[model samples]
Target: MKNIKMTIEYDGGRYLGWQRLGDSDKTIQGKTENILTKMTGSEIEIVGSGRTDAGTHAKGQVANFKTSIDMDLPTMQEYLIRYLPQDIIVKELEEVPERFHARYHAVGKKYSYYVWNNVVPSAFERNYSFHYSEQLDLEKMNKACEKLIGRHDFIGFSALKKSKKSTVRTIDEISIQREDNLLHFTFIGEGFLYKMVRILMGTLLEIGSGITALEVIDTIFESGIRSEAGMTVPAQGLFLDEVYYN
Candidate 1:
């Protein structure tokens, strides 16, 4: 068997998320697997570095799968490009060691949440960005990010009812930048809880808009309560920018 690795990019506007549902083809993983199955003449399941939630796009998402088909990467790439849905793109493909599992071997991930902070919204970016027509205090938002940028019990930021695994994760960085009317919030971390990035974005938006105190990040960390954070922002604004192995 050959272990294949690939970088995937997709516009997650119409899918039910990455995980394959029971007989549902409206998912990135399901769509990709279906094509792989057709190529291999057997059931083929690929493992992603992580799941990008529904309506969340990806630019450099990673995945790996074991295939016994005696095929070259170029031929496989051409096959996928010609057969898979238009929105999904296999950026690159290569053969790797059999032990390289995408999710298990992942070292870090980078996610970006985009906000359109303009008086008027863009007609093209409606599906890719969150529109908030209000002034945000970037200085205050940076302050909150400082408190959030370390290893901590992020049980409060997560959406799980109860975590079977540890909620402690290290956030290597979180920073914001503005260009024209767009505000980009980038998050780099070891790993994130379910919906944690969205939830954290919501909290920062509230703080940046002065709806919540900047120090609330500290309070949420201490309280370990989900309600202490702001609303879970919409998934359309989130993007899985990259997954790191080292």
Candidate 2:
């Protein structure tokens, strides 16, 4: 069997996230796997780099699958594009070494959250960004970002109730930029827990709105309590920007 790697981009607005569900075919994984299975005439299961929450989007999601089908890479990609739903597209496909496992080999990931800060919302960006009409102090948000950089236990910022695996993760960078009325927040990290990025963004937003103190980030870290952290922002604003592998 040859291992085929694929880079996928999806709007994710109408899907039920990336994983295949037993009862539902409205998932990215299930849809893609079904198409592959149909084309290959055999069972095909693709392993994704990670799972994005429902309603979240992805620009560079990666996955891989092993298949014995004789079709070339380009043909397989073309077949996928022609048959898969218009919202999900396989941008690139290539044969890779058999040892490559998408999830296990992933080194890092980048997630971005969009916020519309203006009082008037844009019809085009309504589904892609979080609209917050209150005035936000960008400088205060930047200051809060400083405390979030580097390695720390991020359990307080995730929706995971409990895990035996370590919650500690390294955040290489966190940047917030404003373009007109849109605030773009980017996070480059080794890994993140469930809903971690959304919660982090919510915390920073609260600080920017003067609803929470700057030092609360440290307090949340020390306490590792979910309730102490800010709200988990809506999933529509989050995007899995890229998955890194080497």
Candidate 3:
């Protein structure tokens, strides 16, 4: 069997998340796997680098699958593009060594959250960004970012109720940038727990709005409690920006 790695880009506004579930065929993974199974005439299972919640987008999501078929990469990419939902597209595909496994091999990932700070509605970015009319202090937000950039037990920031696995994660970088009325938060990390990025963004947004003090981030860390953090931001504003591999 040959292992194939594919980089996909999708507008997740219309679909369920990346994982396949019995409840819906609108998931990105289920749709792509169904198409590939039909084309290859075999049961094809694709392992994604990670799962993105419903309504969250991806610019460079990665997945790998093993197939006994003899088709080349370009052909498979073309076939996927043609058959999968219009919102989902395979930008690149290649045959890789049999040992490669997308989820396990991924070393890190970058996630970005967009916030529209304008009062008026954005026609073009309406679906991709979350609109918040509150006046945000960018300076305060940047200061909070400093505390977020480091290795820490992020159990307080994650939406996960319980886990036997370690909640510690290393955040390489956290940056907030404003371009006009749009605020972009970039988070680069070794790994993230369930809804971690969204929860972090929510806390940052509260700090930006002066609703929460700058010291709250440190307090949340010291407390190690989920309720101490701010609300979880909407999924529409989060995007899996990129995946890193060694």
Candidate 4:
């Protein structure tokens, strides 16, 4: 068997999410698996680097699957692109080592949340970004972001329920930047809990608008309680920028 690694990009505006559910709903993984099954005539499961919640886009999501066919990498990619839905694109394909697992072997992941802070939201970006009419203080946002960098218990930034064994994770970097009417928050971490990045973005926005004190961010981190943080931002504004493996 040959392990095929693929870099995928998708506009998540119409899918249920990345993973397949028994609800028979459309999903990114379900669509890919359907195409692969038609090509290989066998049931195949493609392991994804991570799960992106519904309405979250991806620029460089990774996945891997084993196939017994003799097709070359280029040929497989061509077939996948020809058959898969238009919103999803296969960016690259390569044969990887047999033992490689996309989620398990991932070392780091980067995510970006976008906000449009204009008086009127752009029609094109309405689905891709969160529109906030309030003026934001960039300096205050940056100050609050400093507390998010480094390892800590991120319970306040995560969802209420998680099956993961631990809530402690390392955040390698956190950056807040604004260009024109767009505000971008980028997060790089070893791993993340469900809705962690979204909740962090919400807290930072609260600080920028003077709804919360800058030092309150540090307090939330230390409190280790989900209710200590602001509301979880909408998933539509979040994007999986990249996944790192080594």
RMSD of each: 0.9, 0.7, 0.9, 1.2
**Candidate 3 backbone clash number:** 0
TM-score of each: 0.98, 0.99, 0.98, 0.97
Per-residue lDDT of candidate 1, residues 151-228 (tens digit): 999999989899778899999999999998989999999999999999999999999888999888889899989999
- Candidate models: Cα lDDT each: 0.93, 0.94, 0.92, 0.88
lDDT (10s digit) by residue, model 2, range 65-109: 999999998889999999999999999998999999999999999
- The residue-by-residue lDDT of candidate 4 on 117-203, one tens digit each, is 988988987888999888888887887777788888887788856555778889999897778988888999999988899999888
- Residues forming the 10-long window of minimal summed lDDT in candidate 1: 125-134
TM-score for model 1?
0.98
Tell me the spans in candidate 3 whose CA falls farther than 4 Å from its real position.
none
Instruction: For residues 1-246, write the lDDT of model 3, one tens digit per residue.
Output: 889999999999988898999988989999999999998999999999999999999999999999999887888888888898888989998889999999999999999999999889798888889888889998999999999989999999998888999999999999988899998989999999999999999999899898999998999899889998988988998899899999
Candidate 2, pairs of clashing residues: none
Candidate 1, residue 3: how far the Cα is off, in Å: 0.4
Which candidate would rank higher by lDDT, 2 or 4? 2
Stretches of candidate 4 exceeding 4 Å from the true structure: 162-164
**Whose TM-score is greatest here?**
2
Q: Candidate 3 overall Cα lDDT vs. reference?
A: 0.92
Single out the weakest 10-residue window by summed lDDT for candidate 3: 70-79
